[model samples]
Target chain A: MERIPILKMGKFLIVSIQVDMHDELALALQEDLAEQIVKTRAKGVLIDISSLNLVDSFTARILGNMTAMARLLDAETLVVGMRPAVAMTLVELGVSLRGIRTAGNAEKGMALLEAIVAQQAKSNAPKST
Target chain B: MPPKVRDTFTVRSDHDVVTVRQKARQLATELGFSLVNQTKLVTAVSELARNMVVWGGGGTVRMEIVKNGALQGVRLTFEDHGRGIPDIEQAMKDGYSGGSGLGLGLGGAKRLVDEFDIVSRVGKGTRVTITRWK
Candidate 1:
């Protein structure tokens, strides 16, 4: 699966997931996602996996790679709306999601991104005397 | 003809995934799982099927449905006698992935299913079981 580029919304970007067939779209999206990571200078990313059903080890690896790539671009990645069984199956495949932020749904994921961005901006901005 | 009630199908292959997927959906439907459950299970099976074809080179995939059992769901078992993972821990970690698939890796596969389990030996084989319930 090629990387799937993310869709931007303010400081947050949402990446669409093919879910069933991830190769062509997923990989292609990654280049776009990498580009966004740098261009947007966005605080965070929300990968919407709601449309996907099956993700092979290769697909899973790309996801990890994309997230790592995102981090290098100074953007945090959050994987959202993963079905319970998919989560379990991934575990058996010997993969875990430790660093990446996880959200149950897109709305909440976007919210989390907004909060993080707000906090970062607040900390960076000098306080008025 | 339709498969018998609560039937199980097991196959070994190195160049087929569509067949497994079709079989998985058929059983998932016969078992009477919700759309959510069916999608998850089908997706989960797809991951395992791909793994069996790729990493394992060739392996076995078993599909079973537990209609009246304690779980009342569907189960898939994928096992392969391929080169087992060297660093199971790191492999399972979120950021670490070895295959050419998705960055999500095994972690992503788990997220699509309901219940998942695995046991692997250095060279013996890797057995992964995933189940989706009502």
Candidate 2:
């Protein structure tokens, strides 16, 4: 079985989708990301789709599901680098990708993720009385 | 002028779905469709092709380069001989799904293209034909 590589960077996991993923591959990525989140105790997951040209409802649903799953596991998932054409198509296709955060590119996405993690840490920090 | 070109592909597995999307993208690009139009057509193809693999239990897709007057376009026909849709009206709704999908396949695909037509018979199969002009 083929798998998309998930790179762990400190408290974040980055997945760059470079292939035209099939249905099974997308599902596998979802499951694999969940397991990795638990194992690594990661705080954020960044999915870069700049190399992908199209995102159908099936893929969109998987992405949406991934974000939901990651949320339950206490992680933030940010999908970045969507092509302008793909974004137009997604809206016309009526897949809102609800509950999923997005950024223009990986750098911006990373910065946003850092901010989110920092915010979370600040809130989670115990009072030093 | 060149004659119309038609090609057929089988949609039996997940890989086939990706192939269909690629082929559709190629055809749309060759027809000089704008980038956004190409994406929309390819995305629509992805949805319909996956429908054949997941719900229809495999099928065939026919890609045709069509011309009308001076306009060029790509037309695709997806046929599947699996369990046919019982209620197409409900299935076309955005939130309706007979399987584990977002129920946006048919309606969404239709929205992305310029022309859409569907024919289905219970206990038989379904055929969807769509076209996008450039």
Candidate 3:
């Protein structure tokens, strides 16, 4: 079976969707990411979708579900690198992708992730006294 | 006027849905569709093709380059012999899904295309045709 690779980078997990994925593959990724999040105790997930030319309703739903699942697992997910055309189509298609953070590319996404992790760390830090 | 070209693909599995989307993009690109138009058409194809495989129990898709005077467009027809939809109006509503989906496939696909038509019979089959003109 084919699978999308997930790389663990320090406190974050990076998943670059470089191929046009079928429904099963997308679902598999969602499941795998959830498990990986718990196992790696990652703080954030960055999914790069710049290579995907299309994102239909089903794919959009899976992505949304992944975000929600990550939230449940104590992690934040940032979907990055959506092409302009895809963004236009997704909006017209009536999928708001609510609750999923997005960025223009991986650099911006990673920066955003680092900020989120830092904020989390600051809140989690013990009292200085 | 140039001769019209038509192609057909089977939609039996998830992989087939991806293939259909790729083909739609290729054909749209070949017909000089704008980048946005191509993406819209391919996205629409992905929704409709997945519908056939999931709800329609697998079917076939027909692609053709159509012309209306000065306008050239790509038309796709998705047909399935699975259990047909009982209420198209309900099905077209956003957030109304029969399965584990976002229930945006039919309605979303319609918004992405220039023309849309659907026909179905309970316990018979369903056919959806969509077109995007450049």
Candidate 4:
């Protein structure tokens, strides 16, 4: 089965979706990403959907589910590169993607991921007695 | 007004939904719909196609590149002989799904297209038709 590639950069895992993903493929990515997050102990997951022009309800839900799963594993998921049309359709489709964070591009997404991870670390740090 | 092109594809599984979406994009683009319109059509087809498979057991999607004088549009008819919807009004309302979905399938699809129609008979089947004009 064809699969989406996951690249590791520092403490983050970057996934660039370049194909019109089938439902199974999207589900597979969700599973693969969760596993990679645990294996690498990654702090953040950056999903780049710049090349994607359309996203259906099921795909949107899978994206949301991925971020929620990552959160359970102590990682943050940031999605980037959403086309304006896709964004509009997503809103009309009533998929809020509540827990997933979105950015305009990979640079901004990476920066957002870094800030979120830093915030997590700061919160988890032991308070001075 | 007659359609310049018409075709039908089966929607038996999730993979078939992808096929339906690709065909919708191609037809929508060829019909001179803008990128935004094309995306909306494709997304609407995806949602309805998935509903056909997950809720209706399986079905078929018919696509037509229609023309009414100077206006060109895409029309899609989804038909299934599986379990039909009982309360269409409630189903058309958001957040009402008999299956394990977000319940946005019917209402959201209706919003994407310019024209929408649905008909179903209890214990028989369901038919949903949507059209987007350019």
Candidate 5:
């Protein structure tokens, strides 16, 4: 079965969506990512969607669901490379992905993940008296 | 006289939704629309195509390239003979989705296009037409 590749970088996972996925594929990806996060104990997830030019409501909902699921596993999801047009359409469609983080590109998204993970470490670390 | 160009594609499943979006984008690009306009049009097509499959139980998408004097545009019509909408006005509202959706299907598509029209009957079928000018 064809699947979206999920690469692990230290404590984060990178998923770049290159195809205009069908609903089944999107759902599969969500499930796979969640399982990976738990198995690998990842701290953050970065999803690159720069190649995806079209995102319908179903796609939008699935992305949102994936982000929420990641959060439940103690991992942050930052979606990067959203085209300007896609942003406009998402807002118009009323699918405000409020909980998910976003960035302009991979470089920026990586920075965001690093900061978030670092913050989590700080907050989670035992306090020194 | 304006050019008359029309094409039809089937929408049977989620995969077909992507096909329709691709066709819509190609038509919009060929029509010399801006990237933003092309994206908006394609997104609208995506929403309608999904509705046809999920709600209308599969249908056909008709694409037409139209020109009115100096203005050129792409017109899309989605027709399905499945469960038709009972109240179009309610369905057109921003948050009135009958299915498990954001309820932006009809209204959002309308906002993205320059012209929108829809007709449906309770037991017969439904047809939605939308157009965006370049």
Candidate 6:
């Protein structure tokens, strides 16, 4: 797994989460982040939670909400690089995923997002016109 | 918000939720719940406890272990007598926060546990109970 530093790719909200994010703060940020993505009509999103310590119920809910909002705006969200301990803590805290997809790292998430774009392109491409 | 506690567990701060979480987790484990399930229950309890303190104006995290037949799961009731919820349906909406603490949101907590119910009044208080059964 290669370390992919956070960068703005094309048109998407790239949030590199840290370990000390308060649950409320995270939730507030998600609202703004999701709104920005929707307002801009970004392609997709990559949330890097590699440094998160414990994603409590509130934080998890925000992530879940973000996923829903992104979908409403026709954008995909991929949670990337969640630590196993943090993930388990979140599970214990009963953080609902709300059907948001997850990935091992940023590289894979980006690749998957790009794949979706490619697939959409092929499907929507004109038939030999 | 303010709530009068009748029995077990005096909740002073939000951390008192740790006790509720500990007790609930143990009970869930004894009932043969998977580790994952136990964690979810604990988290739900924590949320309720926080709500009691934050929105309900600091009440109590009552832990009731019913030894009666047909009802075996450990039940946690967060009783708070603060300004009750004005609208439950709106409160359940995602990102509907109108308070000081993490919004003391109910939607996620409700989603985490097997059983969840709440009762409240505008000027009375709020009581939220959740249980996880195996």
lDDT of 5 by residue, A1-129 (tens): 778989999999999999889877888899899999999999999999999987777788888898999999999999999998889878876778878799999999999999999998999999999
State residue A114's C-alpha deviation in candidate 5, in Å.
1.2
Ranking by lDDT: 2, 3, 4, 5, 6, 1
- On residues A1-129, what C-alpha lDDT tens digit does candidate 2 reach at each position? 999999999999999999999989999999999999999999999999999999998889899999999999999999999999999999999988889999999999999999999999999999899
Selected candidate, larger lDDT, 4 vs 5: 4
Candidate 3 error regions (>4 Å): B1-5
Q: Work out the iRMS of candidate 6.
A: 5.6
- Give the better candidate number (3 or 5) by DockQ: 3
> lDDT of each structure?
0.68, 0.92, 0.92, 0.90, 0.89, 0.69
Could you give candidate 3's per-residue lDDT for residues B1-134 as a string of tens digits? Answer: 65365788989999999888999888888888999999999988988888899889999999989889888899899999999999999999998886856788899899999999999999999999998999
Collision pairs in model 6: A92-B39, B1-B56, B1-B57, B1-B82, B2-B81, B2-B82, B3-B81
Given the true complex, what DockQ would model 1 score? 0.20
Report the C-alpha displacement of residue B118, candidate 4, in angstroms.
0.6
**Number of the predicted model whose DockQ against the real structure is largest:** 2
Q: Order of candidates by DockQ, top first?
A: 2, 3, 5, 4, 1, 6
TM-score per prediction, in order, is 0.59, 0.97, 0.97, 0.95, 0.95, 0.53
Model 6, span B73-114: residue lDDT tens: 566788888999999998976566765334435876787766
Name the weakest run of 10 consecutive residues (lDDT summed) in model 5 chain B. B94-103
Name model 2 segments beyond 4 Å from true.
B1-5
lDDT minimum window of 10 residues, candidate 1 chain B: B1-10
DockQ of predicted candidate 2: 0.87
User: How would you encode candidate 4's per-residue C-alpha lDDT over A1-129 as one tens digit per residue?
Assistant: 899999999999999999999888998999999999999999999999999988877878888889999999989999999999998888877878787899999999999999999998999999999
**Model 3's DockQ?**
0.86
Q: Residue-wise lDDT of candidate 3 within A1-129, one digit each (tens)?
A: 899999999989999999999989999999999999999999999999999988888888889998999999999999999999999999999988999999999999999999998998899999898
- Report the Cα lDDT for residue B99, model 3: 82
